[model samples]
Target: MAKTVLVINSGSSSIKYQLVDLESGEGLASGLVEKIGEPSDGHYKHEFNGEKHELEEPIPDHEVGLKRVLGFFEEYGPSLKNSGIVAVGHRVVQGGSVFPKPALVTDKTIAQVKNLAVLAPLHNGPEATGAEVMRALLPDTPQVFVFDSSFFFQLPKYASTYALNKEIADQYHIRRYGAHGTSHEYVGSQVPDLIGKPAEGLKQIVLHIGNGASASAQISGKPVETSMGLTPLEGLVMGGRTGDIDPAVVFHLIRNAHMSVDELDTLFNKHSGLMGMTGHGDMREIHKMIAAGDENAKLALDVYVHRIVGYIGNYAAQMGGVDVITFTAGVGENDEIVRRMVAHKLSPFGVKLDEKKNDTRSKEPRIISEPDSKITLCIIPTNEELSIARQSATIADQGDSYGNTFTK
Candidate 1:
């Protein structure tokens, strides 16, 4: 019988989950529940095989949403009971530096994660609550946490450090701890497979753009630099988070506008970004408005692509030159317009796009570069959850770091 792994990604307003057969790395079921604690009406979407189902049920809490997910397995999981699930993997948004890798969940670990809640106010607190609820509801299940920061730990001192007093930096553990690490790791690992050369000897840039966006440059298969700094708000402009803003803007607002710290925090982290520049943050909506000749929508698209192009150049320069460039996440993989525009901007560096290859989407890795392009361009759909599941299984089955390293 094949062992299974359940991966959970809990957010402030929803819970996303997937059940996969570890032996084959195939998803048996995946779903999400949205609008927690809102009006009595909410949405639950589940997909299995080729079928999708939806429910208009109230999910007032993460615990309730979790229970619904378990219920789905009870009703639809094929060979689920007979094939014992070996472990559960959780996508913990903030792991800080306390635990560098996926760890078997314990009360002590939970406490430690909670203590770092202040560092990731928007994520760790609620994520820990969901983990706690999981431990209570499924006491017998072995669990592991896969951090989004783990992959960036390899950043060199020069790339990771901020120009501050070394003493203060060490005291607060302040550094460029990049986010979306699981995705970065997955893509980095696959570069060798896709290009048929060792990733260890190449320098590449990875763009992970969805609701949250980030960029990282990998030197010799390790993260050498990334856009997101101490927090998720420091990188390329995202759906809502203001990225790379002037520091003086905060003090200016406080002194000139009399805004409190809390108010300023909420404004930048929540109300800014593409949504701040334009009323809508969804790229699809922005594209529609652009087609209808809205100058603001066109401007937003220009700014977004420009920001991405700027980072590609910066990372390329930082790493000397990029051998391979990849685009993943929602906009990166599916939005041909954005992909083409970004690739065009990088043409100066010998990056070329094969329009025919980029217009299609598939599970398999596809080359989006022209045959004679100097640098390779690829569209790789990221699988962060699968990467987490793989990590969890390795730790559970091997029981030691030496054995765990084999799988990687």
Candidate 2:
């Protein structure tokens, strides 16, 4: 009987979860409950053993959503007791500066997660809620927290600081704390193996392009700089995030547009980026709209690529030069058009996209760069749940370094 870990990634309105086998590195069961608290169109979709199921119901809150999740596990295969779940791991978006590594969740840890909600309001509260519910439902199961910022917790100060009033910034604990850290950490290390080189000696850039996008520069498997700053809203353009916007714009909206601070926050955090550009946050829909002669969609695509190129160029410069570059997450793994567009802009940086390879799509990771391209270009699908599970098992191992879980 192999040990399994349950991984949960709780967001403002959703929870993505998976049960991963530590021995095989396989997701035995996975699902997502989204549109949480919505009056309508809320549901959970579960996938297991090549089968899928959907339940449409009004999930008034995280507690209700989690209750339904447990119900599904009982109704579905792989019973929790039979599955041998030894630990539960959570993906917390903001752990502040206190946690530089994955932590065993406790009452103090839950309180701290709430304390940092000011840093990631949309994420931390919901994550904390999910953790509390999980603990109550599975009281015996040890819960662990794997922070999204832990990967870049040791970021170089020069790259992490803002040019604001030093005293004010320090007072508010303002500094760059990058997000999507587990994905970056997972894929960044895989680069060396894919390229047949040592990870510690390589200079790399990881582009995690999805609804929420970011770029991270690594020297020897450690993050030196990343696109996201202080919060997930910084760096590259995202589905509904205004990344790298001029700071003056916030004040401009407040004074000129008469938008309140909360309104401004919602504007930048929820209604900006591709959503603001083309009135759609999904890339697939944006592409469909673009095919129908939608100029706004076209502009959104251009701006999206433009912002990504800017970060890639900057990261490359920050690292002096980049040896390997990877594209991961939703858009990077599936959208050929976006990949081609991104790689085209990066031609100057020795990222020569193999057109056939760029168009070729597969679930397996593979290089899409030309034979002689100086920078190795590849597509490595990110598995954040697996990453969290691995970290959780390690944290729960209790002095056993050889946890036997497949690290991948």
Which candidate leads the pack in lDDT?
2
Candidate 2: list runs displaced more than 4 Å: 399-408
lDDT of 1 by residue, 317-362 (tens): 8888889999999888888899999889888878789988888767
User: Where does candidate 2 clash, by residue pair?
Assistant: 176-230
Top candidate, metric TM-score: 2
After the best TM-score superposition of candidate 1, give how far the Cα of residue 262 lies from its true spot, in angstroms: 2.6
TM-score of each: 0.93, 0.94
Model 2 has an lDDT value of 0.88
Off by over 4 Å in 1: 400-408
User: What is the model-wide C-alpha lDDT for candidate 1?
Assistant: 0.83
C-alpha positional error of residue 181 in candidate 2 after TM-score superposition, expressed in Å: 0.5
Q: In order, what lDDT does every prediction score?
A: 0.83, 0.88
Candidate 2 RMSD computed on C-alpha atoms after optimal superposition onto the true structure:
3.4
* Candidate 2 similarity to native, TM-score: 0.94
Alpha-carbon error at 214 in model 2, in Å? 0.2
